[model samples]
Target: MTLEVMARCSAAAMAALAVMMAVGTDTVGQDTETVKPDERSKVSQYGIRWTFSEPRRVGRFVNGDWWVVGPATVVSVTPKPGPAPEDEVTEIKRNQFGDAAHQDDRRMRNGSMIVIKSSGRQGYDSRVKSYDPGLSVQFPRPLKPGQSLISSVSHTSLPNNNFSHKIMW
Candidate 1:
């Protein structure tokens, strides 16, 4: 190969290596913050809890930090019609990590925040003639083994207190 061509090729390879190294540095410490399968809790509604056998990662932010929590079974509560059905109640009761699972959609209970990660029947009552109310959730940190988690069923809404301002000309 010609000297100039070899120099250009070498420069291109160096540039590629530099890019890879930059990305590698960004992910260097990610594994330590990651939640292992055993570190994740077996969370279920009605207070059933356990750890996962396979490691799982949940959410990832735009900056690349991952949600360090379980990829276990997450059941979300859906809006129920008048005279809530048994299955509806059961689904809500099964969302052990509702608070962590529903952080994105702002699903709340009492004064606490609850969010769901799954949608469709995974988080709602199929029999209810209602729109889907599932949410996308993201947990803040890794959960310990056998950690106790619960879903929030009671929903509280802010009262409409917007007052109109009058402009006098």
Candidate 2:
């Protein structure tokens, strides 16, 4: 093989290796799956709550953040649904560190926020008195079996404030 040809081949091989390293492989055990909470609880690290209602969807974000989605329920309640068809609520919990910052930055840059609202009779009657991070928000009243709650968060900053006036959900 000519020296020039060998050099070109080596360069191509190196490029391929660089790309592979950039996109690392996912190890089965290394990837943690999001699991629905058996009951209503707060994830202290991220200041998010896990409300497990019917039909749970648990998985890690693309960035390896853990989250559980189910019906939004009241934390004060007891003996709630657990891995049963009868459960019909869902809440999403993101517990990974930096997830909030990344989400917040994305929302802020995009000039949008995520609003999570409640559903059913419980949501209509019960209001979210307050919300806090790393703590569960206490409800004035217990959520009914089929009720849900919703909340929203928006990004605070944008580049050049060009899209500041625009609203994003």
Candidate 3:
């Protein structure tokens, strides 16, 4: 065969080999398939309880599955006979977990705690206002003889299909 013809045939053979390698046919396992239900409930036995020493100004129990739009804070006090001091304020919100798709947990004073599991999203704006069993709080703190206290709990679901339950008293 002429040298040019021989070279052309060799090039064509190499091209076919490259195509075959790109479309690999190696099967690593059998074709058997099995599907399972997506069961995503985490809290099987969850509970929250709080105790106080005195009473002070109270607010409505804003209950819901809240998505954190910005930072949040919490305040707690032993409740003295006089007016509640401002020093009792406890900032809460620095203890969040995950990057754009991660989970985190946080604890706050005033008998409040939170578990944050988030898959980050830009301009995320979604919240729910309802009662859920996973987010329940029992206040045991004793108010003054005539004073009262307020407690609030919140629960939320993350973008990654995970749920969070928070309680404050």
Deviation of model 2 at 134, angstroms: 26
Per-residue lDDT of candidate 3, residues 51-98 (tens digit)? 223222221113321111111121222211121233433222222552
The number of clashing residue pairs in model 1 is: 7
lDDT of 1 by residue, 49-158 (tens): 22334444333334432232432333222221122333322221113444211222222221111222322222222222222344212233233433222222322222
- The deviation in Å at residue 105 for candidate 1 is 21
Sort order, lDDT high to low: 1, 2, 3
- Show the lowest summed lDDT stretch of 10 residues, model 3: 11-20
Q: Cα lDDT of all candidates, in order?
A: 0.24, 0.23, 0.21
Q: Quote model 3's TM-score.
A: 0.16
Worst 10 residues of 1 by lDDT: 11-20
What does the lDDT read for residue 136 in candidate 3?
21
Instruction: Kindly give the stretch of ten consecutive residues in candidate 2 with the minimal lDDT sum.
Output: 11-20
Q: Which stretches of candidate 1 lie over 4 Å from their true place?
A: 1-38, 42-169
Q: Which TM-score value belongs to model 2?
A: 0.20
